[model samples]
Target chain A: MLETHDTKLTEDSVRQLVREEIQRAFKKDPAKKQACIISSKGTLDWAYPPLILATAAAATGMDVSVFFTFYGLNVIHKDFERKLKVSPVGNPGMPMPVPMPDIVSSLPGMTSMATTMMKSKFANKHVASIRELLDVARESEVKLIACQMTMDVFGYTQDDFIDGVEFGGAAAFLSEARKSHLTLFI
Target chain B: MPDIKEDVVLDARNLLCPMPVVKAGKQIRTLEDGQILKILATDRGSIADFPAWADDTGNELLEWHEEDGTFVFFVRKVEEED
Candidate 1:
């Protein structure tokens, strides 16, 4: 609040200015600075969003939490190299090194080849690798929550995940999502 | 162009979308409110990405320009009430 030497200034106008300032302040509420993302798909192509968004959001000072469930467990799994293979079969839109038919994409070693090609393409495009993004997310303090029920169903123990992974369930995720203004399922 | 100074500079050239913005965001936090962060990136997509990121993070996008093939942006950190 500053002094207004103008004789035209009114008391009601001063109150209005304060109200507007409060509204502007509320625009940056802490709740709005929260992001809760759910990772449900495990494939290499599908793995990027949750990690990328979580890391990106955290970089901007938002409190971020990523709940990994179902096949998404592959993202935090120790064998991510083998677990995060992109299947070329039935994915006609996926660009290929050579124009190959669907049958060729389904042949043995195709998934591994496709994953390798994708890794190289992403690297060439200067996109951060998934592992790098994961590291960034962790460094930025974005919570990595793995679903306990899914782990049990898939016969995965806590030791199967990388360090700093938290085990939780649907309620845990909802608790965070309910408090966050930004929620995503990817 | 008019003279505009920056508090810090980040070279994000060769880094793609999200990475440039992410690095800028991380660096901006180390600055005080109203301090400017200058970024250099080669990703054409950063033309749209930086402004959107600044808006999302409640920071002020002072200005942007291109130098040769690089996209340059200046952002001011907005200190939110915690």
Candidate 2:
């Protein structure tokens, strides 16, 4: 096939390309405005994802909702400061800043120690704390929905959760999730 | 490059990832269409974060540069029509 160099390099064509680039840059779809998250894990480390993502999404003007199920209820529980702690004993491959025997990780109060260390590390890195993220979620009006089935199974009353936390079931979560363009499970 | 004059300037220095973006989102709302906002952030991540945020919000990221270890971003408000 013979090459044809018929296309001329016009200044207006170049300007049109730049204009299209800016227009494309400013295009935001309506679907990306909504986000739904399922927080099904209760570990201290696991808690970060849902809260961090929801708050960040909400900050970006997305209508964000988080549904907490099963053990994830601890995140919205009033006593999360005491109830939420990470244990390193069961996981042999858990990363620790220092090399330590598994025996040390299994000792009593080690979970709390690990939690304290993780909290400090996050603080030093200027990352928002779980509580601070929750506050941001609330301030940003991110919907925090607690699973009703889990509440009933665990015998937790509505008062067990913090203020502004809504009660909902799987159906309710799905209803919100379906409308959201971004759905995540953490 | 010519200095792009801004209508509003936000100092988001020393803030983390989402904080800067969140603050910028809120600030941009107060601006009218075609208005430009200048954000000064210390977080290196804002280099990418601002453009991503501007794209998500239907705003214009005119230009961004680094000065004295600070990431300065100029974002023009472009309201998304319903």
Candidate 3:
């Protein structure tokens, strides 16, 4: 009877150990839940991807960070609304109301016209604007990091950026990227 | 349609990709465990996005259906244990 009891106790302990091991395997480490993104373009159309992905990741309960370098700094700039514009010159993919030659698209004021058209089209489609996306990103606590080297090259001061922006270098971005399984360069 | 009582109603109509899920995520934070959130979105992407978002956030997606052009989702909040 004692041997049988000892055997039952051993079996119960083994089962308990297996259950704990299974739970440990299934439980995701909260610290590793992160997303890192690099936004490299400044154009109005190019700005959406990073912000959209960052906000979505944050909504899914993951920490998100967006590294803005080069022209991508315009996304965090205070004058982003005025600075971000879409240019039709040398861009054949852009759907135009009327097909125009490259020369016409290259003419002065074409960029502004293209920018306006794109903005209106997005608005009509109920797509979130850059301003709205930034608001959501900020509210969701998605880290927006501006590359210090790019800011210096572009003659942008720390004061030129919008609120909640952190100044960082490539190393800072790499450190964050290393910890995240999802990293994208856009 | 089976009546599912919701603790909150979020109108994310006409919002594009990410907005519906983003807003729904924000709205769901206000609810307690097991409280239901009803989301009305016009974005076609929500059909796929909501399920993915629910699964990612550890929330329960009770049911989803389409009415006219709107996609309706009912999700139950599952509070995470630290």
Candidate 4:
């Protein structure tokens, strides 16, 4: 038996519609005034993201903070020349100016050539340097926190880092992270 | 079209996002108390991004326009008293 009547929508359906409308009305929030970036890669390519993001966050007036843990400390260390090195042993896809095999890249002069080429390319395109980004981050008051446990394991003294570095443990990072709406692991 | 003088001109034509803002930030630091900076960018994101950046960083976006398919923005560096 079909009872023909205009079935009114229920309250739950209206509520659900309103809820979806509200959700859709909300915009994607930007990164917080504070951020925590965990740097673990010592390579030049892997280093750029953290620095770029940190500097950009600061430029956006966020209380940006980067926590250097493990290999991440190399980016902010005093002896970054030796601290940050790229090994071509396992890298099969690293671009070479010429078609050079893995053995050639492992040669003494090839890495330096590659590094120089990368730096020049970045400069030609007006990309900021790692050091420049670091400076901007520092100048903008971005807190550079060095992870203490990682430092102990890596045998890095407090003096091994540049100025404006704060040494902290995981708890310290967490405290900063709690207040931040933006937390990144790079 | 008459050449409207920009208080400052930041030529970020081929540069990327973070670089443009990063350089602009440095340039802004060097300007006088109420000087302005005009940024030219090819990165499409900069059109929207710079305004938010200006607001967040306490700068003021005075005016913006399109020129030769590039985005030109005029920002006044806020004299932050801290």
Can you rank all candidates by DockQ, best first? Answer: 3, 1, 2, 4
TM-score of each: 0.88, 0.84, 0.90, 0.73
Q: For model 4, how does the per-residue alpha-carbon lDDT over B36-69 read when each residue is reduced to its tens digit?
A: 7888898787887898889777788888888898
Q: Can you tell me which runs of candidate 3 are displaced by over 4 Å? A: A1-26
| DockQ for the candidates, in order | 0.66, 0.50, 0.85, 0.42
Model 1, residue B23: displacement in angstroms? Answer: 1.0
lDDT agreement of model 4 with the native: 0.78
Which 10-residue window in model 2 chain A sums to the lowest lDDT? Answer: A1-10
Interface RMSD of 2: 1.6
RMSD of 4: 7.5
Mark the 10 consecutive residues where model 4 chain A has the least summed lDDT: A24-33
Lowest summed-lDDT stretch of 10 residues in model 3 chain A? A1-10
**Candidate 3 residue lDDT tens string, B1-82:** 8689999999999889989989999999999999999999998888999999998898999999999989999999999876
lDDT (10s digit) by residue, model 2, range A1-186: 113322764788668778987765644545568899999988888898999788778867799999999999999999988878888888667678887687988888888888888888878878777888888889889999999999999999999999999999989988888877899988
Give the TM-score of candidate 1 (chain A): 0.87
TM-score of the second chain of model 3 compared to its true counterpart = 0.96
Kindly report the fnat of each predicted structure, to 2 decimals. Answer: 0.75, 0.47, 0.81, 0.59
lDDT of 3 by residue, A11-120 (tens): 77778778987767656655457999999999999999999999999999899999999999999999999999999988899999999889999999999999999999
Candidate 1 similarity to native, TM-score: 0.88
Cα lDDT of model 1 by residue, A2-49, tens digit:
566256668898788889889787675667789999999999999998
Clashing pairs in 3: none
- Top of the candidates by lDDT: 3
**Clashes per candidate (backbone, < 3 Å):** 0, 0, 0, 2
